[model samples]
Target: MAIFVHYLSILLISAVIFLLLRAYRLRRLRLPPGNLGLPFVGETLQLISAYKTENPEPFIDERAKRHGSVFTTHVFGEPTVFSADPETNRFILQNEGKLFECSYPGSISNLLGKHSLLLMKGNLHKRMHSLTMSFANSSIIKDQLLVDIDRLIRLNLDSWTDRILLMEAAKKVKRNNKSLVGLGPSRLSSESKMALLITFELAVKQLMSFDPGEWSESLRKQYVLVIEGFFTVPLPLFSATYRRAIKARREVAEALSKIVKERREEYEKGERKNDMLGALLGGEWEEDQLSNEQIVDFMVALLVAGYETTSTIMTLAVKFLTQTPLALAQLKVSCWKMSGTDFKGKNHRTVVKLLDDVIDTSLPW
Candidate 1:
């Protein structure tokens, strides 16, 4: 018993010394003050919880109070510095290329592709941005896109009967409508709502010149997988989300490569479509057109950008119109004016203004 106790005492002394040495070494590194939670996950859950709250500002405020304007914390598997200082943010932005390169978490970078606009840097970023803007220029938007947007909006608005948002309702269960919650009889079934959103997604997909055919369904499924895996803890190989995302990304890349090849062949044969993809390829090769990978990334960016947000916006707009009869009446008046010759003056500027007002009113934020 005496021998065992002696060995245990030695082991405890060694552990204490090791911990002290580690603490001293860490202090020497001058890392800012804050907790670096568990391995892998770090403070991700806390960060997520902060944003999920009704009043999220308190999360940052509480942290700032505890650990000055700038502090270090492990978040999303990275040792990140959270700064509430204005100067630090401005300095970082101004020194983006020289001092620091813009970056995101591994999950985002891996999912968005290395060549994506969000991931690109220096001249590559400039070229991609310029290319995208050229395709989405004022002329294209005014002549082609505005008409598509108007037509799509009108169609969606016309086919609106059941107007309860299932996800939102689930968050705050105040109703027992079986149909609205996908339980019983309803005008707009859950499947139909999904189909409608898919149709809207295809309308947005047209901005990239992808025909709303078989590929649309495949792309939509992949999109859901990618988005689901985007911000999740990336265990790579071991994680289901990570694996799904990787598979989806590969499938997306393959599909896009096939489309690119077909489009290129079409362009070569003198059959140029009037979509963004067509615009990108139709122009003469000035400084070398985008590669298949780059094109795919651009299309993914645009499709992801427009898909859910537009669907949610339209859904909320319909909901707001139903709840607020006065707003609905005003919107009806605007729509009536928009369809008349009087609103057609000044290149339909009046109609556009009224529509914008109605949209602004409908949107919560």
Candidate 2:
């Protein structure tokens, strides 16, 4: 008992000394004003709890009220500054890699790989950003992407029937009960799943010209595992989710690497294609030819970004539209108009305009 108590005292003293040293070091820096919260865990728990609630702004609002729009807090095992001021955010974005560098959590950086565009710095980031933007330019969207989007959406909508639950359909729920007494397997419904499939298919088409198939579906399943760990604690030993994510990330990388190698072989054989993978291998950007590993990492990051966030935005748009009758009515009218008209030149522009309005109004943040 005496020995145990002595060791406990030593541990406590060490922790105190570490915190004191941290505080002293922090004091030297001109950090924004805010509480750092508890030691080790910091304000992460509070941040997570706040996000779980519908009105998450209170967490920031209370802090902003006390300490202004820009404040400091520790999250994901790092000291971070929260900037709510639009001007500060604009400045930060405008001066990326000059005044500030990309500083994602260790887990995110590990999962995304060093070559991922989200972690790229300086000249490399500029080049990749320009390349990505080139693919997403208005010409590409109107001429190529919009056709796929229209077809896929219409195909998905065609499958919808009366009495179908939108959220359940989106989520791809497998079971439904017709009566209190009877329970049986029903047609799957999930807006989120539908959105994921649509976006994933579109992205795969654009990136690799890969059609939706068993292989793509399997890859998508692995990606879901990777996304689940994005915001979790980074300790693999303590976090089963993180461990699974790490494993899944490796599998995803391997799969992408194989595809990239195959594509490179195809390119070398004088078989040219017009997708993003082809663009990478076609020596279009001869100044800096990305390695196979870099290409794979880039694809993985793009797939995650395209698949996850787009689906989330779609799901949220549905949720928000359901809540707001006026917006929902306007959206329905727009959809009706889109469906009734031929999707050509002027009509396509009108459809795009309606889509922009829907996106603008439906986004929660």
Candidate 3:
């Protein structure tokens, strides 16, 4: 029994020595300090859990505390190096082509398409960025898209009143035999909340000039599905979120392709429209025009960029406004000062007119 115990102790010590030796050899090149967690999954679950929290700083904070500003970890099933140092991050971004090429997670690249502007690198990326930026510049917004956005916002707000059953939008003012209608809801309710979401969707639709009859709602649905799984694991298992996302991505590509075909017919007939898609198809870029697939990818990228972010901001802004009285009061005061209206109006045209007035009167600088 004593001899058996002695051999067991020797085996344990040998295993420990072997592991230490392996670790040292692995770090012989002086890699950043951090744990890789486990094989295959690595620290993906931990990263997801940390980001799921309201305050995600602690995940990095704890690591930075132990391993310094620059460290390594396995996240999203990739061996990743995280730099908390701003200068280092800037250096990496500025020297992207030289030091490291731009890349995305497998899930995102798969869902957004390998040809997406976000995933592209080198001279091709620069050309794509330039083309897209030309369509989204301040001059274009002021001249064309802003007018469309304002119109859509008014229409969406008007439609909202009809959809909501739980909120009263206007009050009756009676003077003797005459009845006068006062504008606006007294407070935010469940109905207004629903209206806000629809307004955002409508705004995105009109801004992008997606065909209102068929493609708008279907495309929106597919885009939403793709977005919901953009950060999920890129597993191809049956009924997986990633699988659904890939399917939705293909559907979106099909829809965009159809639209591109229709637009081509419209261009042939000399019917030029005032939307991003129309501009892209009609614009004169003699040598470097985008192919149909590239245009579709760009449109998808643009839609994903604008839709999710704008909706999220509106949702969070409404939430915080309702929860924070002081902030709400400041917003009301600022809006009134900027526009000279209290935003209490039942007529969509009236609200739009007020906005136009504000824009007309504002200083250019």
Candidate 4:
């Protein structure tokens, strides 16, 4: 009975949409030139169905072939355009003006917090981007961050750790290195390390809600819960979980407030530091213009985005090298051959440059 009602509701809505689309103001949409009609179920089934077979590359290739380098279509009830051309990508990324604006589906915005630079628009987006680039840019990364990565590799191997699950072992090594580099010499225990892993898991689940993937029916059904209430919904059985996390962060708040107060004092005495929180609370942002909630939202967004790509790259290096034993051995030897001073010295970029060359030459992609 419910299934019958679902189909009936869909047909009714589609008819109404089709009629409205043919109305004078929306007449052009009735003749919209793009992918052919997908019917009441829309393109959701086609997308998820394609993912069921492990590889969706062929489907994407077919669409690209039919549509050329840049073309448009409808998916998940929205108009989507695809571009595989480098020039088109460069244009979208590099040439930004009033004409083009970035936006995501309303569903996604409801999940991720507000003011995230990834989801920001126009002037607000530009502001957050400049503020974040202060910390993310390579030029500002500490020399110790690079060296500690090498030390982390050695320490992980030295732990005697019996032949471990390669995935878990890889994560352990990557976690130590990322934390040290990102947090400026913060010491963390094994448990703290696992917290980072859990955070990434939650974040990936957040990204996957509308990511067009095939999973068990169970996972797909859970998407509704995950996407709708990431911030607002508190887990009932989890025992005041969100509240506790909020309470715990007050300590971090006091610390930030102290730092902000000190920075003001220092400015009165003529001094400055370029730390992320400092730059955010910098005079240009105007203390009154920034709310505490906004600061926390920005910090949480940074922490989530910062760790994901770093861990993925670290895992990529391990996974790629493992498949090519000779390359793995070469990397180990090369890393050792570069004495500790290599990065700080004239050949500072040499290690990353060599890795880039290795990635270009060796990656199966």
Candidate 5:
């Protein structure tokens, strides 16, 4: 019986190898050129390298030059297409709603819950968008979110006089902003502040794992595990039995729940907040609208979406300053100019220009 089992294993291994080779040969014959790595794993290693190579854009552009605008490559286990041609990109980016629907990871609904409008499709998005218009207005933004944003910025700027570590500074900057704007109030009790900070850090860590570079297969698996807990169905259920998605999924949910509860109370008492949570709470939905758990999930999704992008841009700005001395000097100069600028139309455009120039330079190709 044992001898028979050993032969069975050998046959199974041979079949798998044969299938992989067949796929490789077929792709080579027809598909676009690419650095196809190992059979199943492919260039996943390169996509997930620990020590990222500098000038990632050129690395991608170089590949595009060799392999046209639209090419196929296997990263990890999935076949992904890189599109850069003007017409194709315009179609994908502008018409993601019409031509194509986003396939956000199933894990997203797992963590953020099913009720988030971000997860909502089609008419649902249009419906919620109608409500969003009221809160998205300039007056509402200035009153609720921007004031907190400036307050957080001033706090961060005051925290440093001469020197600070850029990455660490960027972190504190995110925390300060999250607490002030995302958390509904600048001043929260110790419990709420710690929860917000810890949860925010965990969520960001999971999301930021994917930097553009070569990724190792092992690292990819573990990294996915770290971030996978919040999946629509815990990833483990798909792989083996059940496994929880660590605490990130739960912590974010809890923090969101607290925020929603607080906002509801405040709104009940006649205090309006600026963040998306306020928009969501104030919006009209169907008879059920959303449950508290689901609302927490939506808030978690929003927090990750809104906050991470802002923090990343700030991080990119700091990284840019490291290379360019003139840029660093300009950041200081810009800060000073912002302080002197009045809150009026003419001054606003200049303030915007200063920000725009810095941002445009800092952007990655």
Candidate 6:
């Protein structure tokens, strides 16, 4: 008992000394104003709590009122500086490699891999960003992607009949004794699943010219695990979700690596497809000659980004459109006009222009 007590005292003293040293170092530098909250855990619980509520802005709003747009706080086992100012964010992005480095929590960084576009820096990031942008340029969208998007939308929409309630469909809720019950073992809402399927299918098609198949479907299932664990506590020892995510991430990377190698071999054999993978493999630029590992990481990051944000936005858009009769009416009218015109010739431009106008006027950004 005496020996155990002695070791505990020593550990406590070491921790105090470490914290004191850290505090002294921090005192030397000028940091933004804000409380760090409790040591280690910090204000993460408060942040999470606020986000769980209907309105999360109060957490930031109260902090901004107390301090400013930029304030210091600790979250996810690290000290962080929060910037709510638009100009400050713009400046940080503009000078990313030079003045700032993108730092995410270990959970995100580990799952995304070191070579992910989001985690990359300097010239590598610039090269990859340029490549991605070139692939997504307006000409490519209009000439290649838009037709696929239209077809996918129409295909999905065919199931939406008057018998199906929009809210119930969006929530994946079923009526049982006048009460709503969630569907599926995963518990993912119907609208979210639909959005994810659309986005994932489109991403795979564009990236590797992969059609909707059992392989792509299997990959998408793994991605659901990865996405679900993104915001969870990063303790794999204690968290089954994190553990599942880590396993899923590894499987995804391995699968993508295999595909990348096969695609490279195909390109060498003069078998080509006009997809992002082909561009990376066959491009003349030295920078475009990425390794299989890099390509896998890039694809994983892009898949996560494309599906998560796009699906959330799509689900919310559907929800809002259902709520707003005026916007829904305008959208329906625009769709009716599009249905009458041939989507191949001059009418293509007209349909695109009409869509642009509808999106501009109907959706509240």
Error of 1 at 201 (Å): 2.0
C-alpha TM-score for every candidate: 0.72, 0.80, 0.67, 0.55, 0.59, 0.82
Q: Which regions in candidate 2 have their CA more than 4 angstroms from the true location?
A: 1-10, 65-68, 90-98, 138-141, 158-189, 316-350, 360-365
Could you tell me the lDDT of residue 335 within candidate 4?
Answer: 70
Models sorted by TM-score, best on top: 6, 2, 1, 3, 5, 4
Taking the tens digit of each residue's C-alpha lDDT, what string does model 4 give over 145-244?
4554554455554553664565565555444433222121134334333333433433333222112234312332232233222222233334243344
lDDT of each: 0.65, 0.75, 0.62, 0.50, 0.53, 0.75
For candidate 2, give the lDDT: 0.75
**Per-residue accuracy of model 5 over 280-362 as CA lDDT, tens digit each:** 65646434455677566555555455443554455555556555778778878878767854434665556557768778866
lDDT of 2 by residue, 1-365 (tens): 99999999999999999889878777788798888876766787787666555457899999999999999887766778999999999999998768877678877889999899888877888888888777766464456677777777777766676756675552332132111111111221355557777888889888988877888888988877887677666778877878999999999999988999988888878997778888777645656678999998888889887775686676666666666779879888877766756556787788788878778766554
Question: Which of the two candidates, 1 or 3, achieves a greater lDDT against the reference?
Answer: 1
- Candidate 2, RMSD to the unseen true structure: 6.2
Q: What lDDT is obtained when candidate 1 is compared to the true structure?
A: 0.65
Top-down lDDT ranking: 2, 6, 1, 3, 5, 4
Off by over 4 Å in 3: 1-30, 93-100, 138-141, 158-208, 211-214, 286-288, 316-365
lDDT (Cα, tens digit) per residue for candidate 3, span 231-293: 555556633766788889999899888888887788779987666777677675435566788
The numbered model that scores best in TM-score is 6
Query: lDDT per residue, candidate 1, 197-301, as tens digits?
Result: 555455545655654456676777787777666655676755787789888988988887788889888888998876777866767443587787877887777
User: Which runs of model 5 end up more than 4 angstroms from their true locations?
Assistant: 1-42, 57-68, 105-118, 129-133, 143-146, 161-246, 261-274, 286-288, 315-365
